[model samples]
Target: MATPRIESHAFPRSWKDLIGHERIRSTLSSAIAKRRLGGSLLFVGPPGVGKTAAALLLAQTVLCRRQSAAEMNPCGQCPDCAQVRAATHPDLIQVSKPQDKSLIPLELLIGPVEARLQEGFCHDVHLRPMQGERKVAILHDADFLNEEGANCLLKTLEEPPANAVIILIGTSEQRQLPTIRSRCQTMRFTSPTGVEGRELLRQHIQRLTEAGQSPPSLADAELDEAIELAAGDLQVATRLASGQSNEIRGKLLTQLSASVPDPMIIARCINSHLDEISKKEAPLRRAGLRDLCSIAVQYYRGELREAARQGRYNGADARRLDRTLRVFREIDRSANLNALVDCYAADLSLAITGDRGSIG
Candidate 1:
């Protein structure tokens, strides 16, 4: 498969180019200036924030031969900086969950157990840097690190190579093992502000123009609605700006407002719409699930407000709504859209009608 070519300037090459997390950049700069950078660090945040970008920028800066610690910037012209940007630097390593499987396999971290620790991420980090002053290994799917994998990494986290930095990136701290979390310095990232979200959307639009691709047909209130719906996640905002959200929202409003809710009917309706989204693999499939779930939540929130206005709010109704939300949360964790949709649809029916319901 061909790699997507990002317009040069659209790719985040420095801290300044990253979309959000202003304080994270400042704090990292201070650490570099004081030489207090931790050997092991964990970046915890929601998806589409600047965690990965910040990690890459910091890695490039750390490996830049021409930059002083006080400078805290990569000399972009250096061989080290160029290679890092192209992801070809020998000293920079990145590992993520493979598509075929759900978890980050243990071997990807420390090599096959039979290798006797002779090769792998852990073993490679122990060796001297092949090109730069230090090695930077980024574990991208830290949330999927199993017990054995986390244990395999513990030693390195405790006493890392003299000039190595190991950074774990994950969505939430709670998803990581306590033992692993305790040893690493943690950086928490938050969603961008409303203004920042709009700016990020515009930047993406500009990139489309530069790439000679027509931008999505959305403007003014519709664009703002997408930005607000995205809640500061740039990737989600991009999808929303493409007008997918409006289509999904329209379907959700009609079905959720039906006088006689039918879980099976609603489930089939959603399943059909999502099936038409594209045969384009996992990420799109996963995004469709997320968008549907978000619409359901948003729709119910409005219903809750109206019910309260009519003095019809009650504990049982609230509990049913909570159950519906929990199903969405589970969908995120498991990434199993099919398994949860029926249950979610049933819960939504119950929540709306205050009656027991099940998808037949």
Candidate 2:
């Protein structure tokens, strides 16, 4: 196996440090406490949620040298806990997609599809732990597993190594191969909202402070603005803690509230701002588009509600709003940002003036 340098500087010290995911924490704690922990686990959830963090916590709990039968929590002070935290535990094998490639290569698991027991994560997992009682293999970015790579893991999943746990981290069960999903116990994570979201944000801010890092000075309203734009996403909320969210939200609101909104101008402004946010990366650009689309939807929904309150409801307004959402979905899936921008501009024009011919 690759014996790269490992450190716990990036991870939380204990499960309690993980924000939100109360149900996930309880279920995992019970499993650990009852000694009913399965050998294969699939953590499925949206981005920025604590799925990977939960998986790591489970590893820490299993490898903790100081816990008793009555306790399921990691002591965060034991040598084993420190090793696991630092990712230096000989029993723990963590694998993920290489930075340059999109998919987790089959070679990472097996030397070749035809090879029988060559060196790889699968082979390494089967070997007995060098230090701890149990081996824990954490495979991150499991969504990027190709058919061949995933199939190679089936045999091990079906008949796992004794005293070992294999945790696969993915965004959704649907994205994983059926065979892989069937062989593993699945846990779904949901993004926290409302009080939960706010609490999570507060905890993260506290962590930053504890780390001796100074975040941008933000007022209560500015903090709330970031949280509101984040829509219960902790990672997004944390990124917004730097005050970038306010700038983006302001631009979006200004465009929406323009007395005579020009679709071309609005689209250009949005694309320009998103380009800055994304730094020209296609994936980040798409994410920026999605965020802008969410803001636009909120604006249109408010307009529709206002019209209803005034007893001047227009079916066309609702229709345009729905179309804007559809366009957002399309933009998210499309690769050609330029073409998507044109389509988005046209759609926004339709919403603004009810004229499809306003922009080509």
Candidate 3:
């Protein structure tokens, strides 16, 4: 069966709707209450978390005409709130790296050669708010900002327009330039885990049902497996709950644990699964392959723990885990997916069967 896509409404619509990040919520709420929220903010966290959603919620709180900002409550029925939700608010400027490009183009920060400083994100941000007292700008994929692009944004970060809030969302603080990191109030977010993660998933499933959407029903075992595979990523868990990844995972574990796993068969199974999930799109296929590798890493680690518990762990077991780790990292730089898969399968087979040979 095909994986169900998460709907827009599934995303957080208010601070209360946002899952996890309790400390962040309290800090921002206190700042807003005291009218001391900074002009430039940096949100650093893993993907599938609520960084962007929190940014939007902040915008709504500051711009909502029906409610006072000090209350830290956005009246969702107001025009300002509606515009922000639809991403149609003139005062809210959002930018992200283009999928086809390796970096966020410098022109996006400033302007094209013919229109330098005349029009672009920097210019748009400096403009006075059209409907409210505040303007909010969010830059997604801030990790893709090249040196020139970062430089162009330096001045804006140093001195944002009055009542303007600029948010840069990325995976880690280390990925950002020193100047960018130093200029903004940084908020770190972590993925939900344990009871929090389980509650988050349950809430999502409940929301789908309440919204009258007929999502696939997950069995208790499947739900637990999805949670384990997702590792706190809600989006991945939703996909796994659809019953696709579970099948692939079962097959992968079975093959990896076999005494004489066939490299050709393993490669074919993985390739076929990738094709199904990615719809023949090369980028998505590569991403799926990396996710599968993450699963393998987990499996191998579990095996090592069990072996150690049984007093049978050895150097070969440690080497096998290391090989899997290397393969996971190399997937991003690999040019030929088929060749990489074939070689990885062969290497894994050799490691499992006590052979010293390896492709890498």
Best by lDDT: 3
Candidate 2 residue lDDT tens string, 1-26: 33334346455677777777778878
Check candidate 2 and list the clashing pairs.
none
Task: Give the poorly placed runs of model 3, Cα more than 4 Å off.
Answer: 1-8, 202-213, 219-221, 258-262, 283-287, 304-360
Q: Worst 10-residue stretch by lDDT in candidate 3?
A: 1-10
For candidate 1, the lDDT comes to: 0.73
Error of 2 at 355 (Å): 23
Best by TM-score: 1
Sorted on TM-score, best first, the list reads 1, 3, 2
Q: Give lDDT per model, in order.
A: 0.73, 0.72, 0.75
- Colliding residue pairs in candidate 3: none
What clash count goes with each model? 0, 0, 0
Error of 2 at 106 (Å): 2.1
**Candidate 1 clashes between residue pairs 3 or more apart in a chain or in different chains:** none
Q: Which order, best to worst by lDDT?
A: 3, 1, 2
Q: How many collisions between residues are there in candidate 3?
A: 0
Candidate 1 ranges with C-alpha deviation above 4 Å = 1-10, 204-211, 217-224, 257-260, 301-336, 352-360
